[model samples]
Target: MTNFLVSSFSLSAAPRNSVSRIQQELTIAQKQVATGRFADVGEALGVTVGRTISMRAEMSNIEKLKGANTSIAQRFDTMQAVLETAAGSGENLMSSIISNGSTDEGIATNRRLALANIGQLVGVLNSSYGSRYLFGGGKTDTVPMKSDIVNDYATSQASGTVDTAWQTFVTANAGGDPSLVTADQMKSFLDNEFAALFVTGNTDPALNTWDLHWSNASSSQTQARIGESDLITTSASANDDGFRNMMKSYAMLANLSGESLSDEARQVLTSRSVETLSTGLSQVTDLRSEIGIGQERISRANDGLKAQTFILKVAIGKEEEVDSYEAAIRVTNLTNNLEASYALTARISRLSILNYL
Candidate 1:
C-alpha cells in the first residue's frame, strides 16, 4: 500500500481573499447605490451634500418672497379702498354743489365739509408704507403743501394805485409785455411776487401790504382767501393750474357769500367745481388702477416663485434622498454577496494539504 501520510491541511487562501475583496467592493457599491449618488466617495459626498443644502436655501428664499408679495398685495387693496372712499366723497360734494347752487346754505356747508375732506385726502396722500410716503413723488418724507397762512391776496393782487411794483420787473425784463414771459419766467415771477407780498422790508416800499388772519380765531397769521375767485388774481398771474383753480374757486365763494348769485353765475361755478373734482378723481382712479395691476403682477410672480420652489425641492430630494426600492434591492444584493463570500471563505478554509494526503 502506498504510504498514506495525512499531513496537516488547510484551505487555499486565494478563494477567501477573493471573497473578502468582492465583499468590500459590494459594500462600497451598495453605499453608492443606496444613496443615489456617484460611486466615488472622494468626490460625491461633499459635492452632493452642498448642492442639496444650496437648493434648500433657494427654495426657502422663494417662499419668503411669496410671503412678501402677499403682504404688498394686501397693502394695495387697502389703498384702493381708501382711494375709492375719497372718490366717492368727491363725487357727492360735486353733485351737491351742482344741485343746490350758492343760494342754499347747505351747499356752503357741504363745500366746507368738502374742503375738510380734501384735508383728509392730503393726509392720505402722505400715507406711508415702510417709512415711504405714497404720494410724495419720490420725496417720500416731505409734505407737498405748506398749509401755512400768509397774506397772499393784498401782496399778490396787481395794484393800480402804487405804480405796480411789478411794472419795474416787467420793464426790466419783458419790455412791459407780460405775456412774452414763458412758463418758467412766470413761475419765477410768481415766486418772487409772493415773497414780496409776504416778506417784510420789500424792495418796493410803495407796494400794497396786507396782514393775513386765520379762518379760526385760535390760529394766528392764517391767510384765508377773500373769495373763491380771488385765487386767480391773488397771484400776479394765474400760473399753476392747481393753485389758480383753488384761488378762483375761493373768490367765487367769497363773492356769493351773503349775496344772491345769478343762476348763470351759479351754473358757471358749479361747472368749474365739477370739472376740477372730476379731473382729480380721474387721476386718483388711474393711480388706483395702476396699483391694482401691480398687485396682479405680484400675485403672478408669487405663483411662479412657488412653482419654482416646488421644482427646486424636487431637485434637492432627487440629489440627496435614497430611493427606497433601489436601496432595498442593493441591500438584498449585498447580503447575497456577503453570504457567498462567507461560503467561499469556509470552503477555502476546509481545503488543506492534509485533505490531499
Candidate 2:
C-alpha cells in the first residue's frame, strides 16, 4: 500500500539517473588514467593548491634560469676557444722574439704571420654572437677593435707618432743615429712613445677614426644573474690586461720589422717583445682560470636547478596528479555499476501491473 502510489516515470528515471552519475564518474576516472592528472585539479588538490602552485612557479623559474645559463655557457666556451688561440700566438711570439725573429732568414714569412696575428687578434676582439660583441663590453653592436688600427699601429714603426718621437729622441741624444742610441734611450723611447698607446686608450684623431676599441672597458663588462642573488661578469673586453699586453707585443713585433736587423736592434726588440708578451701570457692564463671557475660555478648552479626542478615536479605530481592504477580500478567498478544499473532499469521498465497481481 505504501508503494502503490509510486510513479512509473520515477521507476524508470531513478536507475537511469544513478547509471548516468556512475557513467560520469567512470568517464572522469578514465580521463585521469589517460592523462595522469586529476580531471578536477582544484578539487583534487583541495587545501594543497597553494603548495602545488608555488612549486610549479619555482619550476618555471628554474627553466628560465637554465636557459640563461646555457647562453652564458656558449659565450664562455667560444671565448675559451679564442683565448686558446690568442694565448698560443702570444707564447710563440715570445719565443720568436727571444731568437731575434730568425734573423732575416724567414723575415718575410714571420712578417706575414705577425700581420696575420694582428688581424686575427682584431677579429677575435670583434667576435660576435647574435648581435652581441664578445669583447665590446656594453657596446654589443660595436666592433671592439678596429682592424684598420692594426695597420696604423704597424705603420707607426716608420713615420707615426712613435716613430717621430723615436727620431726626435735619437736626434736629441745621439745625433739621429739609431745605432748609437743606448739601451737606456731605447727603453726611454718605448716608455714615452709606445706605452701610452698600449696602456691608455688612443685619442689621436689620425689613429682611431672608428672611435671603437676603448681601453677602459672593464667597467662596462656585462653582468647577469644566474641565480637569485648571484651576479657574474659575462664579458671579457679588449681592455683586459692580457689583450692590452698582447696588442702592444704584436705592435712592437711589427715595428721591429722596419728596424735594423743588427744584434743591438734585435736585443732591444726582443727585450721589449718578450717582456710584454710574457706578461700577456700570464694574464691570459689567469683570465682562463677565472673563466674556468665561472664556468664551473654556472654548471653546478645549472645542475642544482635541474635537481630542484625534478623535486618540484615530483611534488606537483603527488599534489595534482592521479594514481593511474587506482583510477583504473575505480573505472572498472564504475563501469560494472553502470552496466548493472542499466540492466536493472530495463528490467524495471518491462514490469507491468498484471505481473505484480
RMSD of each: 15.3, 4.2
Would you list the C-alpha lDDT of every candidate in the order shown?
A: 0.50, 0.73
Candidate 2 global lDDT? 0.73
lDDT of 2 by residue, 185-263 (tens): 6777777666755544445645641233333233377889888677788887777778777776766766545565446
Which lDDT tens digits does candidate 1 get at residues 1-357?
787654323344565666778677677667767666546533555645777777778777666666656656665676677667766766676677667765677657655655455455444544556564444443445443333422232233322211254456556767775444444543454446423433222345444232121111111111212222221110001122232233323333332222333444345445655665566567666666766766666656666776787899788667655666776676687778778878877776666666659
Error of 2 at 340 (Å): 3.5
In model 2, the clashing pairs are none
Q: What is the TM-score of each candidate against the true structure?
A: 0.50, 0.82
Query: Which run of 10 residues does model 1 get worst, by summed lDDT?
Result: 230-239
TM-score of candidate 2 to 2 decimals: 0.82
